[model samples]
Target: MAALRAACYVPRVFTPDAVLIERGAEETPMARRCRERLPDVPFTVVEDRQAARVAIGDDFAAAKRRLVLAEHRGSFLGHCPAGTRGLRCCNYLMMNFATNCPMDCGYCFLQEYLAENLPLTAYVNPGAALAEVARVLDKHGDRRFRIGTGELADSLALDPLTDLSADIVPFFAARSNALLELKTKTDAIDGLVALDPKDRVVVSWSLAPEAAVALAERGTTPIAARLAAARRVAAAGYKVGIHFDPMIEHAGWEEGYRDLVATLAAALPAARVAWVSMGALRFSSGLRRAVRARFPGSPLLTGEQVRSADGKWRDFQPLRVAMYRLVRRYVEEALPDVPLFLCMETPEVWQRVFGAAPLGEQALGARLAAR
Candidate 1:
């Protein structure tokens, strides 16, 4: 009898009306408990008792059924700009699979980004979005593509309940031309453990110093646990990736980051890595206010930041460059040949740090494909 994890009881945070709960035919002790607890909540009990009983252990069952909801058919994917809004635009694609996160990070942009107060909006139908992606790829077949699901949500946080990776992994596996990166802050990899570990699917995790994780990132899996999961996925033959985005500058920053990079190098060899990206903290004005309201104690929102041309607040240029340079040095020392990139940075910043302009997603995709 597995325990049931209720996502959120807050109406504004996670509208119960939007959630569709489907119970397995032969209800496990856990399911029975949930049914008893929320008798009024709408749910359909599976009639095929034998199959439902067996599916209780199947992690993908919930995610597979959730796909039946066809509400998000027309609107779910888009592009974001680089540097300033009117400046260079990075050809990035965002797959709006789900919204909000179960894990509460004080610095999360979702607090302001979401139109509704509800933290979770699971787009039940991914097939529709996939069809659109296929169309995009067919139209742009010659161009290499880099798209990620982590933009709108923690790609794999609810994976245990949704099994989205099981469906998404095979989709990308069939499409050799496009690269799909699943970035997460959790250790939920059971759904991906059995998938064919190919270059088409890059499993990535957001990393921060242990102190930061302890102080600000609430409900997220520990750094050690996340790295262990990454190690397991890499061992299973997948190209693993990491992001040190929103890198916080606190006391003993160098020692903290060095320890983090060292742990990563020890856990997985450089050969299994596809790429790693570094990004300093950047947030929209609305998002910064949300963070301050939700987490008044968080020091992340207290740093000296300025609004960039893109209308988002970020660390000053010199401080940002220093952070990037330090992380680049660490990666080069730890994994000499592994590819490194910067996220949402300016060409000037790129030239100063890496001696080259940041490559567009297509070129970045090509570079990864070539590797």
Candidate 2:
């Protein structure tokens, strides 16, 4: 359980250019932590979240560096939007404590999804999210809710500044009906290990090859460091998950993935890994424009993708299936007993890989949510 870089490990800190606080959010716990932690950053109080967005002036990607603490008055927990009409949805759920990630991964959908939502926002009122979760779990007492907070933000990236997870981890640890999944591409687990999840939490990491990471995933933890952090978390008595999502079909991609899987298999023991999921690279045509404008040299734009039934451009079905089967084969050979699943994929693709698809998204979600 020794860390590869623990002695010299410095948490990848995210220091925003300025912190904008929405009027009533000033006294919120999240705002207080940011003020206390980021004493050097200038602070401004805005009338509302939209006003804070107007205060920050930068391109879409660069705008992410500005932190906006505001109140989210709407519902917090909802079904993941990744499920498309024809796809076999994982029945995943998402809770956004924050609205956007500080890291600028080239393929991040927020570039298009949140085109108007400029600044990275941390909803100062987390009690609302916890309350929403309690209500859902109360109603669905017969079911286990596997809720993830990373769909709209890097779950752990803002941990140092917001301390949101400290409150969330213990909350989920106390519940039997909820399984909180903290997914991230950062090695920011210092606050995590100090807590005991009691097996009600999963610390998951989304990974790509080291070279792919070096190119497009900016300001994130290296894959090696992520795996090392996973080991440490697993040793600390928490089950970890792996996501090889948005798997890019870059040149020499086969070799890249082969080596990447080997490294992951070596670091992640089967028993410690709760689940491993994969999704081929796919994005809306609008996001393609965003990626080109932001990262002109990104290799993600080089794939032979075609629009799928979901209306997003994805690798052609045949090629996508081939890549999944190959990676599935690699994982089967390496981590023989771990549960593997596909994310946001068609039933045809699911049938081709696993010989069958779930009865429906709810059935799939029920199966994965089981303790």
Model 1 clash pairs are 12-118, 13-118, 13-119, 63-162
lDDT of 2 at 217: 73
lDDT of 1 by residue, 7-50 (tens): 21111112132223233322433334334544555654443323
TM-score, per-candidate, Cα-based: 0.80, 0.94
Clashes found in each candidate (C-alpha, N, C closer than 3 A): 4, 0
lDDT of 2 at 76: 91
Q: Root-mean-square deviation of each candidate, in angstroms?
A: 8.5, 3.4
Candidate 1 segments whose C-alpha is farther than 4 A from its true place: 1-70, 81-90, 115-119, 360-362
Candidate 2 TM-score, C-alpha based: 0.94
